[model samples]
Target: MEAFRNAVRMVINRSSDDQQLDCVLMASVQKQLTEVADAVTSVWPLAALSDLERRECAKTSAVRRFPTRSIVYDDDRNSNEANAYFVLEGRCTCMQRLRVRKMTTNGRNRFALIRDHDGHGQSHNLDTQKNVQTVYVKMSDLRPGSVFGLGERRSGRVVIATADVKCLLVPLSFLSKHNGSNIWGRTVCSLDGTNPTIEQSFRKFVVENRWEEYKKSLANDLFRKRRP
Candidate 1:
């Protein structure tokens, strides 16, 4: 019975010692973790920053690291509010149809109305639902045979005209420079032979300068304030 008591006492003492060792290990681990956290906090003071300040700082940094490219204008001409210049990237049947339609529609003062009637019902005039087509022209696609209508003239002798118009035609060469196509090295000019040398000079200037005037005109148009 004495031997049995001694064995039980030995087991109890070992268990207590193991528990003490576990506590010491746990305390050491906690201390190490606290030190790591303190080091991180010291190195990065992000915790002290306000949300707005952080956002602003991030924005400024982004702006500084990545600057935006400024658009340059070759000519100073502005298109009229209604006129648009589009670049002809490639030839297509749809483009031809659109150009023809625009020209035809521009001269028309009024259009005919068509309406469908139900059985045993009377048809009414549908003139209010006039089909007005919107045309999109890109800056790179303006070429000879591209037409312009009358508008105000601006700086750089550039005139703005609607692509859809009846009279007052301007040559494609006067408005844009040809990079390396049949239209290259040309400028749109007034059909009225006012100044041949000026037209030639303008083309030469645009080609030599590698400047793009139409883009500037577009930018100016887009940002221009509307008069009340």
Candidate 2:
């Protein structure tokens, strides 16, 4: 309960003084509150709020609430077009579903495993590692996942909307070009079961690469072919 209060205070402190309380802020608060609820419910299983907890959390975070609805979008890969829906039923601390509407098309899905590490001499300090939160996202949607690579075997995949996809997941350092362009550092790739950070090098990398452009090109190509 103390931790929950502190988390809420931290959130409130960070908000702008004049800013009106809004759904986004409420969502942030609810997420933190849910984290606390999970920790407490674990030890006292009988007190678990179960599905009601999730629904309440979602409602508290919104001005208006309704039953979870499927989000349909065209899939761009097959050129026949496809759609995917997200069903919000239950919630675990791991994946919290938020409702949103969008379109989709068919194409290949890609994944990248990114691992961040401390600088050469900074490993001894606890503060250096305390703030670390490692998460893997689908290259296309930036959705969190545990695995990377193709096929249903891999944990994360949202059908490909087009071809010409280049998925590269690296540390923020690499993405920000902090280590200089064309230089790749040793990082672990979860593609293989073994976690190894091998020193690899590259050139011509940008702070933000052409990922968006690549996705657009693939979508356009798929759309063109499907046109009669």
Candidate 3:
């Protein structure tokens, strides 16, 4: 909870593009989130929000199209204003491929795997000895109704459009702007899982798979300092 709170603080501390044409409807979105913030935690990628909430999200979000094989976000690089997404049409493929450079040592090879919020599997390799090995993480196919990127580290990572894709994106600033009430964060967490069991299972999968690096990416992204 403290981590989440800190993330909210980081987001709130950033500047917003209120003058953008896309922000015209943000007022309505703010109001809706304010009304329902207490009842939720994480926003579920599937069907967790109410009709009204969904409608408001749609109102505030902008529809964007990307060509096939286009990069959505890069790992460790600063992401754009938008922090969340709801796929409206088409598909996205997030692939985490490993490139091992041969080193001249006899140590050992250690690897850490991270599955990102968009369902992409990521593996970070650390070698004590100079060795060369190619590792491939699982592939994630994101389709319509998939919600992702909220509160996650997206900078320097690559998310590509597998096909022509359309998505409704909600800017991170919107959530930060209303986080003072604390309801906004709750709403987000509430949707990550409908029940504790499911949430636990999801968490277990991440932990057992040693996705701590992936989790840190999100934490670092959310808490890092930014210039206004």
The estimated TM-scores of all candidates read 0.21, 0.15, 0.40
Q: Where in model 2 is the C-alpha error above 4 Å?
A: 1-28, 31-228
lDDT by residue (56-118, candidate 2, tens digit) is 433332221122222122122322321111112221111111111122336532222222324
Q: Which ten residues in a row have the lowest lDDT in candidate 3?
A: 38-47
After best superposition, candidate 1 residue 218: deviation in angstroms?
70
Q: Tens digits of per-residue lDDT for model 1 on 1-228? A: 999999999999999999999999999866755543332223222224455533333332211011122111113223333322222121211111011011234433232212234365785444444463322222222232333222212223322222421121123332232123422222333522322233343334334323344566567787785534
lDDT at 77 for candidate 3?
Answer: 52
Regarding lDDT, does 1 or 2 come out ahead?
A: 1
- All candidates in order of TM-score, best leading: 3, 1, 2
> What are the lDDT figures for the candidates, one per model?
0.33, 0.31, 0.53
Give stretches of model 3 more than 4 Å off.
1-59, 76-80, 97-99, 104-136, 153-156, 175-228
What is the lDDT ranking, best to worst? Answer: 3, 1, 2
